[model samples]
Target chain A: MIRHHLSDALLMGYSAGQLPEAFNLVVASHISMCDECRARLASFDAVGGALLDASVDDLGESDAAVPESSLAATMARIRAAGPVERTRPQVAPRRGLLPAPLSRYVGGDLDAIRWKPVGGGVRQAILPTDKAASARLLFIPAGAAVPDHGHRGTELTLVLQGAFSDASERFGPGDLEIATAADEHSPVAEQGMDCICLAATDAPLKFNTLLPRMLQPFLRI
Target chain B: MVRSESVTRADKPGEASVSKLVGKDEMNGTAEWVAEMLLVASNSDEAAFAHLFGHFGPRVKAFLIKSGTEPAVAEECMQEVMATVWQKAHMFDPARASVATWIFTIARNRRIDILRRSRRPEPEDLPWGPEPEADPADAVSLQQESRILGEALKDLPDKQRELIEKAYFGDMTHGEIARVTGLPLGTIKSRIRLALEKLRQSMT
Candidate 1:
């Protein structure tokens, strides 16, 4: 089985308009199977177009390029249109957990926090950061060990609040740790506050502990 | 020497004379006129805005459809994109891209946003702020087909080429293409399968 989908590379081709017609068909087919790739493709298209639009020339030479309307008027229209917040409707909050507002930086419910019990009295919510598989955010409570495991994905964590320490590095609020899939490390939150972090994961976690490995089926983390 | 096309007089009750000017082409007419009107609109000319709206609105709508937007969504997004154009007329820097590319980009972004929203559950509101103003430095520099896939596309088996164009440009589904093209669905699928492999190898 192909371990990783090739849709991202295909999307890059599409965005560049370099994908030949034959390849374009295959990429489209692959996109139907891969939600992650679909979202990335959408992002690439949006960002690429916006970049192109920003570079265009002004309307004619004789006219001074200023709109007839005042800035206040435009702002008023936007205000009337209301704040364009892109938050998805929640499915009822899971049992005892409170529903957190999904992040707008990524698309849709893909950013929702899915909490799973890891081990050692710790529960982790996997938060997808964006459409691209590069990053995810993991939230863990105080004094919890995330199990002795290595990542099967790239992991970048931004400590939102509280502190956590791995063998070599100590992470505090606002500190970011960038780790690759090959990195082998386990993190434990300090005794004080819960460690909340934004992490980007490229794939599943490879648990090194037998207990976590056994629990993986039930925990679904 | 030009003959008079028309002459309107006040009190003498004389008939008007028509003047004919030679070498006038329609191509030279609308582009220059539209460009002039946009210039005026940019200068805060209210009349110019009206003129531009009457002319470009339909064209923009058609452009959106061609770019793969659904009709209803395209219409709504077109309005918003035009409003944005009006609001940000002063910020347009001509050194980077042509006017068509700029307008097309706005429509494209709006379409993407709508697509993203449709994929998820409808929320009470969208969370992101309005798209930021365009950066001056990020203009599309690569206009030429850098990878040159012409030969690769030509080399594709006819069955593969037909399915691809229908799928990508025509926006037909695999099953739909099968019905219309009279090819077995599996045959269509595998043709595309091999086509992609060959194309990727060549392009990369």
Candidate 2:
């Protein structure tokens, strides 16, 4: 385990944007895996918001020239291209650039998975596990959720499309969720669109319902 | 709490001294303003960029000077940092960090690059130590948080803060800090770890 604990000071530093770059990256990565930290950060954000609302004319302004039409045009072009679409697009070629353990799940061609509808109009492709570990990708219609269930072991999910929120925080595209054995939360895709996520699991699901529990044995994830 | 006690011992003097210098409310305000400016700049507002540059450019230059860079080199690094701001403004994410924090990071990285380049022995001329620490009076004129941080920094056992300043402000790697400080690599790492923990506690 990492020696660091997510304290209020760290959360405030993160939300107020005071951490060193390397430290910030470490905290960001940690928050992805640790919901407790995420919740604390959210609280810090609230405090920051309240503080900002009460203050006025506090920060100094620097005099730097803004880019001309050339930069503006480039940004407009990129924005017009629209958001990248793919319920489970191929693991970006940048997967190699990630740390080793993270790269393992994203190594293969991500587009090849066969998506099958499970429930709530969500499609899932249970990726074949190389060893004892199991991984799956879920594509949920807007405001949908998988059957209510809990994980038996570690489950890592990365949002590939749209956004989703559980009881705690909302995750957008490129956001990762690393859930361990103790975490038990169900996420619902935001309204008006579908949410697609890449999920890697180490064990089978523990469905709340007896019927789904029976089906879990036959199901791949 | 087992580890907390040892950490508290390192920070006690610095924390007490710095706490008297600044109010938490003022620091919060400064942080918020920086975040707002960053948001405006990211939106492609030329005026906003100018406002930010005017305010932060000198601060960045001053920080470099304190880190031991010559005025000329500090000015160059400041310009480079602003140029990066212009080029990578879109990468600014308010959710991630405030503008001052982001600019400081850029400045820190640039300072590191300059120091690294200076480390090589030039055939014609030898590199000198970084410009003398910035004027103590000028350093004092900064915001309360900066003053507090600077004071707290001074209160740290010199050996520990020196390694930290070299690694962070000077951008020296662990091995380089070890070489300059004449401490073992493991010792340097332990000092930094302890220093960071102390800094975190003091800030709280």
Tens digit of per-residue lDDT, candidate 1, span B11-48: 11211000011123322222222233334333444444
Estimate the TM-score for candidate 2: 0.32
Ten residues in sequence with the least summed lDDT for candidate 2 chain B? B119-128
* TM-score (chain B only), all candidates: 0.41, 0.45
Window of ten residues with lowest summed lDDT in model 2 chain A: A53-62
- lDDT tens readout by residue for model 2, B1-204: 422322232234422122123244443333334333433433444554555555566666666665677876666666667666655664443333345545665665566467653211101111111222222222122222332333454466767655544444344432243343321122222322333333235334
Quote the true-contact fraction of every model. 0.02, 0.00
Report per-candidate DockQ: 0.04, 0.03
Docking quality class, candidate 2: incorrect
Off by over 4 Å in 1: A1-116, A126-143, B1-80, B83-109, B114-204
What C-alpha lDDT values do all the predictions have? 0.42, 0.47
DockQ of 2: 0.03
TM-score for all predictions? 0.37, 0.32
Residue-level lDDT of model 2, residues A61-132, one tens digit each, is 222222234244433443465532312122222332222222233454445456786655878876443434
